[model samples]
Target: MMQKKAVDSVMEKIIAQDLEHKELESNFWTMSNHKWALLAWASAELDQSAALVHLDWHWDGINDFREPESRGELSALASLDELREMIADRDRPVDYASFIAPAILFGLIDEVHFYCLQDDTTPGLSSDLLDETRAKEYRHHNIDDLLRTTAKLSKPILFDLDIDLFNRATPFYLDGPEYHERIRSFLGKCSDLIQRAAVVTIAKSPSNYWIKNEGHYDWDEELAGELFNEIVPIVR
Candidate 1:
């Protein structure tokens, strides 16, 4: 876990449009920020044309730092190190709020389909990268609908989950009991998807929706642990 100051400094690097922080390894990752999942995806030898199934509280479809003239460069960045270098070289940052579009442009994923637990149905922010890439976004509030739709798709599935989805009412509302129930319900109902996913990436999104404790962000770590324990066996 990064100190509050370290987290803040990294957040500052991410442009306001793609608000977040950074890295983790492995096929199943639980990082402080969702943006780092970008690198995790690149680390794997996933299908070049995989379809992303994003289950989160927010539609993280913003492309904060898109270099249109650098399209060839972006597509050429096939390795995790190359992607990290490209991100470091950019003046603006690639963050949770806006990494999806670039993932598509980079040939990492073909399209992104969303299932937002919160009522945040706003479309992804428009940008030059999204315009030319195969990425398209939408909201699927119903689990059955989301499952049925994905079942028909021929593309490989990359399941991306954000912990914030379990506690959707953040800043505005907080219900401890309801939060636990939401987590249980999702895990119970989505076992099939968990088992089916070609790759699973989870975001611990502490700064975005978690509560602050005596000296640290709360729930993110605990929930991440719980998720790993539950998901590892299923995926394995």
Candidate 2:
């Protein structure tokens, strides 16, 4: 049995606060948000030129905030100061929707293999921003394909998992016990390649921003705890 007590103390506190609110707004813009914090943590642990195995519902690789021309110039940013200036110009240094773009621009990630759920909606990447070399570096595959092909990779992986990938509407969705089992099985299969991992559990709250207002799911303490229990061991 996955122990709820095993959840991180800080996460436990956050969930406790979330339970008190009727609808916790998505705080992806904030530096204190778990998404940014986890990415920051992963960035610190991962070496330059590491492969990021991004498993999520959304593409999240787009340069949405900046214009195509401006983003195309990111390759020219040689120093950390230049990169900081670029991000600061957008007024959002680290946004969840476009963090991967900056990470790639800054050479934090050399390759990104996106494993998204099977859906009709095709997310497009800016052609101007990604030239031939960079375009070849980014590849998209369905989740099932990822499961089948991930075992073949010998390279060190930075596993980036978004819980929303297993949205309630998807076949991967399950109650706590089954969800735990599936995650364990999946991670066990890819454990050898995973050098470090980051997990993001989004509740999909009502947002005035670009995000769609899907009726929020209550992924409070119980679900968060279960997920934490399963993920912590593999990543650690």
Candidate 3:
């Protein structure tokens, strides 16, 4: 149900010319060959959505965004061409949180997972990226990797982070033990509705937050302000 809103507009513009599908679809948004930059935009949008859903995040702003998404609503909202266009353009300025991603998924990853994914023999592995970048991408690229571990996330949490008992907002940055306590505290006391709502919000957010952003409802800003609020009235 992802309408052609973000990518559709740009797609109309680009498709007018005799552009070939495969030409722009050379996985241009990989770790290298970042020619279009739409990958960044797509990543930003996915990151923003992921951060907001799983880790209680929101966007600061974005810079020059070009192109549109080929389709709509992906696992990471990636692989589309127009989205790659919007991100790569120099005119746009997008910024995001740096620290929170690690907290969301530090423990879940390890050397074995890295090596396994790196193995070219593995089926469905993307052979595009160099073994070096794929091995230690966390060192350079800022991809959140929250959903990177698995398609269905056999082990979603890095350390069983939860959002239930968190009846109140907490700091984005935490030291060590305090982080685990907060997540445990929140999930412990959260109601079923709260838990289900939270998951739905997290899943649909990267792709559907714009439904609220588009002025479809009056409380987009209000609801956005208190992400962990767990109050159904505002968003409903």
Candidate 4:
């Protein structure tokens, strides 16, 4: 496992909004950050029409890393040392890790469709799943539902805007220098995504959608957000 400065790790998860979403959720300090073999999810074969996006973010110590607030009660800020102490307690290891990790499930996303954003259907794959599940297996999903599903997780779709920051700090929340590295890896994984595309499973009932990948990683999520804010879609 690649070790990082505890401060950077905390900042990474904070920027990515990768922390626990609920007060009664699991613990996170002893959690293990996942690695994706440094693969790229997008490839040169990507359709031209695909919108180029940019993402950037910084720490607020408030709002729980949620979207920017114009005016309201701000959340409390967490110091690097304090976050570390809470996470280091051995008794809370499992709870801590699960608290801020990518919740794993065997559930299915039915009626999921796909829509090639480009003019031509690029025969490529996606690594979103791979980043979460190390296996290279892919299942065919509903292209139409995947594309046309305007609603994201029972919430209204957000469009006509740039830069989306979720509740958790994702890899996208890292800084410029590190963000470049992430893009390189994501770009390199495009080939794998293309291959996995054919095998991805898509269910049609109830139209299930699994969002959020593994997180609370050691990488600085704030920097990542600043770097790749454009690539991630806003799930409002």
Overall local distance difference test of candidate 1: 0.63
| lDDT, candidate 3, 181-217, per-residue tens | 6544544443332333212222112112221432243
Instruction: List all candidate RMSDs to the true structure.
Output: 6.1, 10.2, 17.4, 18.6
**lDDT per model vs. reference:** 0.63, 0.49, 0.26, 0.24
Top-lDDT structure, candidate number:
1
- Ranking the candidates on lDDT from highest down gives 1, 2, 3, 4
**Tens-place lDDT digits, model 2, residues 1-236:** 54667557655664443232111222111122223422442334444355667766667655653656655666565654555444434353444456676666555566667776646554535565466337334455545566556556554545665555545445556665676577677667656545333322232221122121123444443444445445645544
Worst ten-residue run, lDDT, model 3?
Answer: 110-119
What lDDT tens digits, residue by residue, belong to model 4 across residues 1-236? Answer: 54578878866654343222211111111111111100010111222212111111211101121234411111221343433333333342212112111111111111112221222232222344324433222122322333333323231111111122221243344544565465445434333332333111111011011112234334343433442333321110
Error of 2 at 64 (Å): 3.5
Sort every candidate by TM-score, greatest first: 1, 2, 3, 4
Alpha-carbon runs more than 4 Å astray in model 2? 1-48, 68-90, 118-121, 137-144, 147-156, 195-221
Runs with alpha carbons beyond 4 Å of true place in candidate 3: 1-79, 93-178, 187-236
Alpha-carbon TM-score of each model against the true structure: 0.70, 0.58, 0.21, 0.19
TM-score head-to-head 1 vs 3, winner: 1
